[model samples]
Target: MATFAPANVLDFGGAQLIYELASAIFPAVKKMKGDYSLGQVAKLYYSFIWITSPLMFWGAYLEIRRQSDSILTKCKEKKIFFVLFFLIFSPLCTFILLNFSFESKNVDDIRVYLSFHSRLGMPVWGGIVPTSASVMAAMTAFGIRYFCCVFD
Candidate 1:
């Protein structure tokens, strides 16, 4: 609802309804499993989301900017920020994920292992970054954009 919603407006009752639903539904969800603790869980979700969302967002974001660029050339502010964001933020976010990682205490919580399905299954430090769909999407989104940046 937050990302691609047609409009941002939400009535008080509707917002309250969503809040009520989320509050009720969240507590019923399981907290942690296996040797996986909250730290591990945090890493798992954080790793994928952190490493991936910006890249995916960039694809859409850049595409919009590029098309707009060709048609009108004056408002270059969004592109400047977009380029700066990709160049500066991606690596920074990548490093920040380390803070949330597990240190590999045992077989169940390898800090760097292959994540198959659930983040809890392989977890945050899971060696799934290269394999993640988000990573691929980012790579595809930023395709040639990186190299082009170097020349520019």
Candidate 2:
């Protein structure tokens, strides 16, 4: 009988750290209220979330399907999909975030808004970087596994 081991320590640790970071950052943003333009930008953010939700769900579906296969096969397939998906989707996400606008009464406030937009831009790159890294890592691991299987 084949037995599947549970996820390792690093995965749980990474998930915990990500959760904490997101939780801490979300409240700071939610507390902020700039102007009517900020509200508009928020609306745009919601729209992006709405549009991306389906893609994320589809990705999750692919992940589940891949997981049901042999580990080496699953890793190879997921790595390819992850790399391709992020390469295509990350720029689209950045574009949406980049074009978001907010109405402001003060020029300084507008500057702040733009600065905030620029800061928010980090998340787009951040998301892509980790995803790409993980994909490459998976590919490496799977390729090694497949090579070993060839010997066996």
Candidate 3:
């Protein structure tokens, strides 16, 4: 098994990496604008997704392209493989599909989040719900990969 830690970090933690980038940049965004319309907020959020999705996909590609047996194959246990597969792919897939369908499926949530953003500025915990979500996505991705590698 490959023993390199950094490669795995990049391979699986893409979402968190993007989140950290966004977190670092968001203060500047907040400073540049006092408030945003629902549409503006949605556009900004979508734009971020569009920009970051490729990087995350690239990470997934790297993980799959590992020279050794794939994570699914390297696993000594079938149950563990399925579990890790679900944990890793589900969030990444959901994050992608949701972003693609976001405008249609999440109109109400966006409006509400926009209202909160207007009233209170960025959320104290994270810049926005999307940021929090991406963080969750990153955590899930990292957790699943770490388990798969360690337990395999």
The best candidate in terms of TM-score? 3
CA RMSD (A), model 3: 14.0
The alpha-carbon lDDT assigned to residue 67 of candidate 1 equals 65
Q: What TM-score does candidate 2 reach?
A: 0.26
Per-residue CA lDDT of model 2 for 78-151, tens digit only, reads 66553443334544443433334222335466444443343354234323422343343344333443544333
- Candidates 2 and 3: which is better by lDDT? 3
Query: Candidate 2 regions off by >4 Å?
Result: 1-117
Per-residue lDDT of model 1, residues 7-69, tens digit only = 222224554344344334432112223243333333334333444445555665566446643
> Which pairs clash in the backbone of model 3?
none
Query: Candidate 3: what lDDT?
Result: 0.43
lDDT per model vs. reference? 0.39, 0.39, 0.43
Worst 10 residues of 2 by lDDT: 1-10
Model 1 bad stretches (over 4 Å):
1-77, 103-152
Best by lDDT: 3
Q: Candidate 3 on 9-29: residue-level lDDT in tens?
A: 323455345434654654322
